[model samples]
Target: MPKKLPEVILYTDGACRGNPGPGGWGALLIWNGKEKEIAGGNPQTTNNRMEMKAIIEGLKTLKRPCHVKIHSDSALIVNTFTKGWIDNWIKRGWKKSDKKPVENRDLWEEMLRAAQPHKLSWFKVKGHSDDELNNRVDALAVAESKKF
Candidate 1:
């Protein structure tokens, strides 16, 4: 058998009934033509946490380092990487520009750690748009959140 490529594609979405109410996260990971779906919910959490959790869970599933491209509708998630906010936050001891502590610091730390083993690229997609994978994940997240 031919060796599989070390390239993975991930689509993630999060949904919450209220800003700090029940929430859920969904992720779809594709590698070498294989698909894996992962999801979870929190009884009391923010949308941002669910968003971060989606990507974190996806990355955590990788057994080995790979080149990963993550697609997310959350600007907070996309810009954090594409705009180099993660690096700055780390350099500033997890503080934003105004020296205030970053929100979701715990989740951010876990996400950073989960992503460290992989070479990652972040992409921003229009939420609830025509993207099939993105839409599917969004629906999944909504359904999961409703369970709580």
Candidate 2:
């Protein structure tokens, strides 16, 4: 018989003062009603990189593979997996349909590696609106960015 996998929920967000300036990424991981928050920042990074970092960092924190449901305000991150863009990109040697190199291949590769051991579901949420957890993560990301 196989062991049951624990279910986990993750919420991630990122913030940057300038387009290519100081930035931070934050995430919240929940399991069995307990939640853990993690955040970090870079001296200089783009909003998209920070966004991907939040997800990658969150997944990396997991001790073992489990069923993970990831929620984020960034549509690009969510869509990259949900809409099968990652599959095509990997198939095309990390090139987009336009034959250009993928902008964040490094992080995208990390995202794939961090996620491969688990069952993943991606969800998009409205940012700075009514979602309480999303708002909390946004606050965390913004606060971390200010520290840099």
Candidate 3:
């Protein structure tokens, strides 16, 4: 029989002081009843970039291929993969319907690479609600943004 892959649950969030200002990303990884948290920030960036950064960083932390379910408050992040925005973007050579270059293509490409090794599913969690882990990562992101 084939071995079952391990399972991981990841929660992520991002925060920015302004549309294009200091920004931060946070992630929490849970596996085998343990947890790992990571966060970082950029002096100047957009909230979308930070949101992508959180997922990218979290996925990069896994040691090998696994089943990973990612939870995020940002609809952009969740829907990009879940609703097939990424597939169309790739089909269109990273251009939107209006032929504009996709914003944060660099991170999207990097995230694609980071995620290739795992089987992933995306979930959307309401931001700033009663979801404990989501709220925790949100706090982490907000704190990290305050540093810059």
lDDT, candidate 3, 36-143, per-residue tens = 999999999999999999999999999999999999999987888888999999999999889999999999999999999999988999999999999999999989
On residues 26-121, what C-alpha lDDT tens digit does candidate 1 reach at each position? 999998899999899999999999999999999999999898999999999899998999899999999999999999999999998998878898
Q: For residue 118, give model 2's deviation from the true position in Å.
A: 0.7
lDDT of each: 0.93, 0.94, 0.94
TM-score for candidate 1, please give it: 0.94
Candidate 1: clashing pairs of residues: none
Ranked candidates, highest TM-score first: 3, 2, 1
Query: Candidate 1: where are CA atoms >4 Å away?
Result: 1-5
lDDT by residue for model 2 (10-89), tens:
99999999999999989999999999999999989999999999999999999998999999999998988889998998
- Note the residue pairs that clash in candidate 2: none
- TM-scores, all candidates, are 0.94, 0.97, 0.97
